[model samples]
Target: MEEELVQQSSSTWPPPPPFWQAFTPENIARIEKSRQQQAEREGVEDASNVRLHDLPRELRALQPPLEPADGEWRVFGDKYRLVDELPKLEDMQIRRLFPNPEDRDRDGKHFDRALILKRLAKSLLLNFLELMGLFAINPEAAQDKITDIRDMFINFHHLINEYRPHQARESLISMMQAQLDRTRAETNAIRDAKDKTERIMEGLGSLKFGDELVGDSTPQKDPWATQREVWASALADIS
Candidate 1:
């Protein structure tokens, strides 16, 4: 039986390596080095095949020039500060609260988030207005503009959603404050009602309506005395 098992193990298509040899540092290093080399070769090939012009205009702008600038570009030097110069939007200025990190460059250059939002807003409004005009002229032609308007609105909302956490926190604070105010108002109302009831009770206590009965000489008859006597007589008779 042992001989048969040995033959079966030896006849396996690919024998597993000895456990001690499999986990050796040298073997692991060799495997890792080969993988790194393969990755490098693939990266080089990918880089060589991709051209600058093939990239989108927005992506191309992110690429640095091959040559360094001759002079520093900071015209304002130490005088320049990273301050938000954009005009505040309605009540919640999310752009100011949570500015996009990618929008600002190391050179202190920053694209205006306010301007981007304004442009999107303007585009959405104008497109909707145009669609309305088109609908008035010809409803069939307006359908195409509606898609454009919808896309613009979606883009605008998508940008707004980026600062959703800040908006959500603000909304939560406002709601909590409203609830606290309402609770306080209700408490005050209850307190006022209690005070009013206490005052009414005090006023009723001082009235002279029942005072005259305290001093009256008239004796009131006990209605339940006769019923108790009858019950006692019936019990006697039963006994």
Candidate 2:
């Protein structure tokens, strides 16, 4: 058999460079110089596009001072005045009282509720009046107007239900009753007109128009009978 030889590579290899080699002063200086150049370029670009007149006062005050700082003291010649700081006691007390931000928001909510109530009150009153046929010039047309008024009241009540204000509910109930009263009055007036018309027709039916050709055909018993009948009918209808 031929002689066999085994070759082994050495376990020790040359040590890697030191950690600080890559971060040498020369490399750090090169990086800083590049950063400064980039910053200067950006500054020049911004200055070219920016309008001095549009710049805020605070930003305009960012110019370098005429003299540099000497040790720890600043050598700027700007007018500097020392003003006493506001006392923190009141601020602390306020913060303690209103720990939650919602307290301020509650005031806003209350004002909004007041506004909503005012608007609802106005709308309810207007609707009530319209329903009662108070706008009708002729009292004879009051009966037909009652239905319209009733429907409007129903709609108003539904609207009030949605608002659901316990405090104002009583006031609304009183207003609704007033509307009912007005509607009742209108219905009575319509009945009175009908009764008057009926009385005139009745008196006419009893008289003979042709027989009175030579005499007075007009009935001369009581001049206020028709008026009295109208009043009685109106009272009965209202009751």
lDDT of each: 0.62, 0.52
- Output the worst ten-in-a-row residue range by lDDT, candidate 1: 72-81
Clashes (candidate 1): 0
Please report the TM-score between candidate 2 and the true structure.
0.21
Q: Give the poorly placed runs of model 2, Cα more than 4 Å off.
A: 1-164, 212-239
**Each candidate: RMSD to true structure?**
23.5, 42.9
What would the TM-scores of all predictions be? Answer: 0.32, 0.21
User: Where does candidate 1 clash, by residue pair?
Assistant: none
Q: What is the alpha-carbon lDDT of model 2 when measured against the actual structure?
A: 0.52
Candidate 1 on 1-239: residue-level lDDT in tens?
99877886778353553444455565555544544565576675443332243433334333344432442233323323244232233233223322445546756867565677898887877888888888788999987787677666655665666567778899999999999999999999999999999999877766655334433467866778999999999999999
| True-vs-predicted CA distance for residue 17, candidate 1, Å | 46
**Model 2, residue 25: C-alpha shift (Å):** 69
